[model samples]
Target: MKIFVARLQGTPVFDPAGDQIGRIRDVVVGLRLGHRPNVHGFVVEVQPRRRVFLPITRVRRIEAGAVIFTGRINMRRFEQRTTETLAIGEILDLTVRFDDQPMTVYDVAMEETRPSTWEITSVALYKGRRREPRIVDWGEVSGFDTLQKDQGAAGLIAAFESLRAADMASALHDLPSKRRIEIARALNDTRLADVLEELPPDDQIGILGTLEPERAADVLEEMGPDDAADLLHDLPEEQASELLALMEPGEAAPVRRLLTYPEDSAGGVMTSEPVILPPSATVAEALAHIRQQDLTPSVAAQVYVSRPPTETPTGTYLGVSHFQRLLREPPSTQLGTVLDPSIDPIRPQFTLLQVAYYLANYNLVAAPVVDELGRLVGAVTVDDVLDHMLPEDWRERADYRDE
Candidate 1:
């Protein structure tokens, strides 16, 4: 048998003798990974402002808005366990993204997987006045558990681990300020950096403001230089300076350089941590270097081959070796031998449009940025260029592409 969780709420539970026990207030279910959660029990309101737990095993049948029980119910107050989530209090009526559209959950439909074990199977979404509510499988929805208070910050963060940073940020944006802050506080530095980079300026400021100064600096360091710089630019100069002072000099330098350029310029949006290799580096060495560092696919697409002194960007810009070329060439082949020098790098002051055209014309996912002396300083990625080219509120739109 199947029933909507919303319908179950407020239904009267009767004992074997047909005496009314109480009205159902909420249903509790234990969360499980890779499987539908089974209902544990129900919170039944026995009197005004009083609720008690009635185990599912005690219930004989549910019919016509009333639960018939086979045994006497425990009169003790309902106490939620760490693993339990309230179906009505936590999940029902929450906004979830479904079928590429935002939908409000009107009710959750549960199926009895076993004789006494019921698990949530689908959600009924509110459509319109004349239309019947749309039923969607539970797996088809995103953001369903994002704002579940029972999950706490750690559980909620784990539930969102599979989501892209942008998707997570979008979901978090809809939560109340208090919940958002609590979740933010629970995220590790690297994870927080990724989410912060995806959020809007106001949200970035709000979350960062909640963190301690040193902690905020640590998160900034973990982010790409361009993203960190952008966030710092939006903050008050004094506050930005304080945070910068807390960061390691090496990590802070690139952001400082990026801050010197106009926000929409190539240098401004370019990440300072490109895979730069000395001209002497062999294909094998380059591959090893890339493997050692955690890089996004776009950033790892190529490695810049520059002149000597690899540590602090002191070399003249030579060219780049695409990852495909590296794989095709022998391991002993020097990067300088197969460098693609035809692609001219973008200048610090180039406008966003110029950067876009340059990347498009070169058919490159990323293009290096150079100073007046023609030294490699950073690389502007296609994603960053498009981010600046798109409308300011594009992130808030339901159909916005997060890639």
Candidate 2:
């Protein structure tokens, strides 16, 4: 039961039967539940396994030869032993106890012998023991200014952030296309897509070309359809077709239709992914429907409020209403009242030149696309028309044209 304040590192630990355990590498404490916490447990770096956790209660004391603890404990009992082969979820849930307080271990680093790599590891809880921290119920950790004099951890982190921001594009540019694609695939799709935005079109296309079709499709899936279509249009036709084939047919089908339209036209500029709600749908029902759908804010704008399918075709369109407009109105208000009569929609057959003129004339980000039957099929944005009217890199080529 007695505890002593000793340097955690290099402290020899022993089991209940007096068998040698391992010296302490670091002790993880659980403060997971706010204040009133305790020691999670000591993470011991040992031979054969490299790292394992022992409960604080099982330990007898800090006073003697090697940290002494209750005997008969074996490496098999420690979750760290299986870490080399365990899945990430398994390792995260494994718990360890420190000084009788409960806490979970996380982000454990492990060594892979088969593949020869360092793996980060974690633990959940100790069997039958409470957990505690090395320093219990500790307040905010300060003293960063004192540590910064020697350029400690904080300095290193700041340096890394600076380096990443300063050289992200350069680093990506220098990387082989395959390696760049590998890095991109390793990142969250949204994060990778954001980085792709910063790169030049040529580099973006190069990196995407190097990726497996499915991975490339995943990244593109995160992009706005207009942006995704634009990126696809830049790829070689065969490569573009192959990557599109890799995507879910429903998701890719609309992109393919957009491709058929001249890039400058309303149909080409619009994403086919608009959120459609039956005209009879209540404000509350529409809100719920929008929540369940994965359409983007731009797509949500052209939410085609339509009549019920069973209803005979009405000559009238329920019209598009902005989300903000919906929020301002009572939930009971019918969408028919919110219908914006002033807006003019484009026919699917409109030429790219005609769509551009409408965009330039209206100064609008989006316009509706309707079929011959007067049913809304898609919506286009100004950017889509502009991208086609003025080809990407047109500014750079302007000099040659003038010459």
Candidate 3:
């Protein structure tokens, strides 16, 4: 059997009991002085974001999207030796001389020569980014001197191109700190913002610290106001203030407002941005608004009906129009007609516990916050509440996948 190392990334690895242990993160290959590199094992990311080595001898089958294996995993974290190379992470993007032409390494194909033993047999090289890669004997390519030079993060990012923001963040977190910063620097502001929202506060601050203050502010602006506020809350007051000051006035306004309330208060946890619209907006308009690519699932599940002003601190709060209602009503039906205003809005001063009980009582995925004038200020999602309720390092904790 032949498996392309790049494709093995993120593949689920199952144990003898058919329970998934973890996902494949990278392939560990030991380079010899000459001949093809020996495939040692896989870097399997287990619980708690730990990457452990899985010897090829333990692997029983390599099928679509899954790697079935026998025996109990050691669970000890894997550390790369200087003599070892990561197939997907290190070798995939290396430039090599194949025949007389210089080509970019795109993938390394591992062939099972006999029994459970595997070896790197060939590599897929791209003449150019737009061209399809051609497979050539692994020995044909030169420059595997194993010299560890700083590689462009483009190759690393490309390997994670298919992942969602959360998945991408996990993949990145597994990388070395320097590499993580390198990749973060390569990502554009908007993309970086999305991934940062999924990462823990510490990781967010670490990567943000690497960027210039101006770029850091731009990334913050791209993030959800609530998320940006939460991240800033983690930084030193002076540093946070500097980044906020660098942000555009209009973009910084909402985040600044969010930061004023106590971290555990309703206003602090609520996102200043939600699918908000005037009462006159039609059901179809609400649906279209929620359909935006950037809207999170919880936020998109409902729309806020308000008076004239649509932005946060909107005109007198009307009620919430759940997406289900939008779907059931006529496209031209006004949101105000079917809006659910029976449930009272939470005040900015409400405690996290109070907000949680309110949502639970109303069976709400999200609840709106109102000020003294009854103006809709923001909406607090269940996710936001849970985030604050969980241990600060919950993201750094073990994955529940093993359970």
Q: Highest TM-score among the candidates is held by which one?
A: 3
The residue-by-residue lDDT of candidate 1 on 1-403, one tens digit each, is: 6687766656888889988877776688876666677888887766423467888878789888799888677765566787887776566546678888876666777888888878888877764333256898878877755655433454356445666676567546645576678778889999899999888788899999999999999999999889999999999999999999999999999889889999989888988888999888899999987776568777889999888755435489898899999999999999989998687777889999998889889898998888898788888899999888888766654334323
TM-score of each: 0.64, 0.49, 0.87
Please identify model 3 stretches exceeding 4 Å from their true place: 12-23, 43-54, 63-84, 95-104, 125-135, 140-149, 399-403
List pairs with backbone clashes in candidate 1: none
Estimate candidate 2's RMSD in Å: 19.4
Model 3 lDDT at residue 259: 94
The number of the candidate with the highest lDDT is 3
List where candidate 1 sits over 4 angstroms from the true fold. 1-152, 399-403
- Model 3 worst lDDT window (10 residues): 394-403
Q: Could you tell me how far off, in angstroms, the CA of residue 231 lies in candidate 2 after the best superposition? A: 2.6
Give lDDT tens digits, candidate 3, residues 56-91. Answer: 999999999999999878876677888788888778
Q: Whole-model lDDT, candidate 1?
A: 0.79
